[model samples]
Target: MFRVIVRSSISLAAFAAGFPLSAAEAANAAATSEEDSIVVTATRAPLALDEVPSTITVLDKAAIDRSQDIGATELLLRTPGITVSRNGGYGTTTSLRIRGAESDHTVVVIDGVKLNDPAASGGGYNFGHLLVGDMERIEVLRGPQSILWGSQAIGGVVNIVTTIPEKPLEGSFDIEAGSRNTVSARAAIGGRTGPLSWRIGGQSFTTDGISAISPAFGGVERDGYRNRGVTGRAELALASNFSVEVRGYYSKARVNLDSTRADTPDYAFNQEFLGYAGARLDLLDGRFRNRISYSYTATERENYGPLRARPVSLEARGENRRWEYQGNIGLMRGVSAVFGAENERSQFRSRSPDASLARPLPPFANGKAEVTSVYGQISVEPVDGLTINGGVRYDDHDRFGGQTLFAAGGVWRLPTGTILRTNYGEGFKAPTLYQMFSQYGNAALDPEEAHGWEAGIEQHLFGRALTVVATWFDRTTTNQIVYTPDATCNAASTNPLCFEPGSTTVRTAYYLNVARGKAQGIEAAAALTLGALTLDGNYSWIVTEDRSPGGANFDKDLPRRPRHAANASVSYALPFGLDIGAALRWSHKSFDDAPNSIVLDAYTLVDLRAESKLSENVRLFARAENVFDEQYMTAYRYGTLGRAIYAGFRGRF
Candidate 1:
């Protein structure tokens, strides 16, 4: 099945590339204007998509509404060069990987605020709780973007932008119910009044989910999950050239889980709060623009064990606060300069009955760390149809001292409606507090470093009705952190390096920066629009190597990363205000352990959806997911959903 999908996608790409120029021009004669889209994640300033020398994928509001997926991670799974691993069904722990990089290597941003957790084991953001209820747009930038987005951008960046009021009076609501006794609802209201505009919205979701652990692992009880969230935004236009905006979001979730020891039940409760305030000012008659912003994020988690004897509970909390100022100035014709400075402080706290789980929090002892950074970027079009961009950043960490990073890229447009783009950049990630202060901590550990490059070509045909792109990327990392047992001690001999010799105690392990790794991949994507029909698809081929020296898994494929993956979808609009769509996803076999001991088989899934307009202000929709009921596992002992159906209604006023 995987091979068939790959071959079909390649054929589509070839067809788009080989189409005649005369035919394309004739077909595009009646087509609408192909205005270039603007994106802010590629650089600090807004730039046209074609001018940015990076691989970018944008999911706008229309696309989000059409998919009808309840979770944000489901929408991201279809994107090229991206993959997701979940321990169970929806609302469980979820991790995202870009171009075969580790989950922590990707950075997530929500409305100009970073979402990584300082208290988590690897300081990575969990996507399990993120829903697409009030999102206006999402931009995914592929490659090393640390120069512009700071740490944890070694793989890429996922920037999420929320909705704002666009009219004097408007609102929308949706209600849905599905398999496994699931229920979901969302509503939003927004309006503009004089110089002030405001928007507020909320969502509630719950489900009687399947067991998190597979029955093969001795699990039989159903686990349930519930989530609730709210978001708000307000903006004031103080003057013709200035504006102030504030945004806030809150979400809480409780989920029933299966214990690692079969048959036992566990539960987790989590909450997140995010706030942002910013002001934008236009100077020199709009040629010079400046923005100042402050953002804060806090997260808390609590877990409880099964009620067999006495319940065990664990609690953890983390917070991040940041202040930023950015300026963009039009220095000359076709040239612009962007500069910014930021100050950030992060703290973490944990409490548990077990001393090993809560010792040595941070501040090294005070529970906080501060970082200050400054960055500058320049964009220029020295010649017609050619654009160039360059940037540099310097970060000063209170404990790790300072580091400098640089990035450069260019985009060229050919007369044949072909675009050539390339980029190269550096990325680094500081040691996490847990890595530095835990029982197995290493205070002297150095930060991990990475550098990579990517090049791609995009072609537009049929008057922009058909578009195709292909890209190749390579990245290498040094000083990667890994846990290793005491080198001088073995099961047989104690060489004095062993903390305890001639005792039955387990040997201690420590985090070391002695590993190197590399990942390379090729991605191809195509989109076609004709009359009332639309088709989109993408394919990715990735190769990842764990080159850690003296390791049993040396030069082996990284865990949970499939070598092949593909996605395809088709949608059609009929004459009676009705639409229909179908989608297919496939993945090849992959390993579940670093030593390649466990194998997860290949699997394919199909989904179908339909919607009809009941009136100008109302619509009805339904969908069937995993139509074939294919059984698959993204993790070794986790259960996945089977065939499920849902129906819903949406209304606007």
Candidate 2:
């Protein structure tokens, strides 16, 4: 068992008032990049989309405002090469997959701080609580990007940049009410004064939600959900070439849960806290920049069963503390380098109380691990209209020894507005604490590893009024960790733990690296704008399968990973200061379990939206989601949201 230093963690989290100024600035530039062609997430450096060999999607504030979506996951679903599965309406357990990769393989970063819960089943962030409040930008970089993002980027990286004050004094507010007795309110205020820049935001949301278990499965109850969160960031310019920053985020949520067998008074509450502190230094006419930082994150979860002797059924906590030093340098006219070194400490503890047992619960299943890493990347433009980049990273885990990853990519833009690109990348992922040390854990598991490559082309026509891109990618993962069930264990099990976690009773199985998986896909996207009308769409054909030789589930489809998905939206601005839009989303059938015994059928959904400019700084908007009231399932026997309507107004000053 390991002990956690709560006070030290809090102090470290407060080191920086919030987000680093330098990284924030780079992300801001990504949002306003010329014609949305420039991106920063690809290499943590500003580069035009045409020069980025990897696939990426950027959503600026205007695009976010145009969608008028309440949650972050909802908005992200509109992007390409992504999928989401929610157990029920808002605040339920949620998973997001990119390019058919495991949900935990993706890395989520907010304002330069990585987010994950070491105690969770897969040690991943739950999309349920990521709301679209007081955020200005979102970037989705797809592929196995471990070279620059470290081990967790086996799938990709989702970088969320929050609002930063650009004016002397500015504020924004959003208020809305919707079907299912849902209501939401959010507000933010920030400004720059002298050498200090700061921002603060808060949000409140609640809803009488649908049953967690599908009604088709005999569910019958009106579950409810509630959430509250706050974010704060501040930066101080201590000198002309040096500045310090600090950022913090906190959220609390209550989600109603039920059993598929029947409706019951069961629920779970979750809390998350993130803190960061950093300082930046610039030299040599700003050509050389450096940042030193520290960050801390903690997640707490509790489940309740009212009928049980002890209402508290489960309690768990996870913490991550990190320190880093990064440097960016421009060596020559077309050569630049990004180098960084970082160390992270991750810890988790969990416990469950039994109503049947009169004795108290056993000691918490607690464990801790640490990893140190260093990475270097170089970008160069060897010839006109062409750019190439390569990167390498090395990580040393306390127990797992060491691992190395490499990536390379290149992009060429011709005079005819044609772009060609290709990329190759590798990834590494160490097992989670719960997967290696808990009762159901097997400490002998090996780290998961992956490699992937992609080739793509882009064509622009009509004076850049229309753009289209197509890409094909393939990936292979070995020694992937998976869950296994072994009802019999006499302390004589040969191989155990196959993953998923959070049970306190006698262990039947444990986590182990036993599976090999592969995925291949094609992605196509298009965007067109003519006069006051705009249209954009994307389609993805991804096939994920278990390829382990002689394995029981060999060639079976990965659970919840659809083979096909598409999204399209069209909008037009009317001369009367009103805008109308429509969206269509479709997903193909997928397996519900590893054995592929259960099947989930395909489904389609449509939504209608309209917004009117009330004034230069305010707008009124409304949307009808799931207009056809389509009934479907992303998870076996779990309910999916039906038709719902929402109306709201947003203002900025």
Which model scores highest in lDDT? Answer: 2
Each model's lDDT? 0.79, 0.83
List the candidate 1 regions with Cα displacement exceeding 4 Å.
1-34, 308-310, 355-366, 485-507
List runs of model 2 lying over 4 Å from the truth. 1-38, 491-506
Model 2 gets an lDDT of 0.83
How far is 227's C-alpha from truth in model 1 (Å)?
0.5
Model 2, 1-653: lDDT tens digits are: 00111001111111111224343353354345254444556676545556678887767677788888889998888777898888877898999999989999999988788899999878988999999988777778889998878877989988887777767899999999999999999999998877888899999999999999899988889889999999988888888889998888999999989876677899999999999988889889878888899999999999999988888888999999999888888999989988899899999998777766687775788889999999998999999989999999999999899898899999898999898899999999999888886667777889999999999988889997888888999999999988766776544544333232343245666776889999999989888888888888889999999998899989999999989999888899999999999999999999998889999999999999999999999999999999999999999888988999999999999
Indicate the worst ten consecutive residues by lDDT in candidate 1. Answer: 11-20
TM-score between candidate 1 and the true structure: 0.90
Task: Assess candidate 1 and give its lDDT.
Answer: 0.79
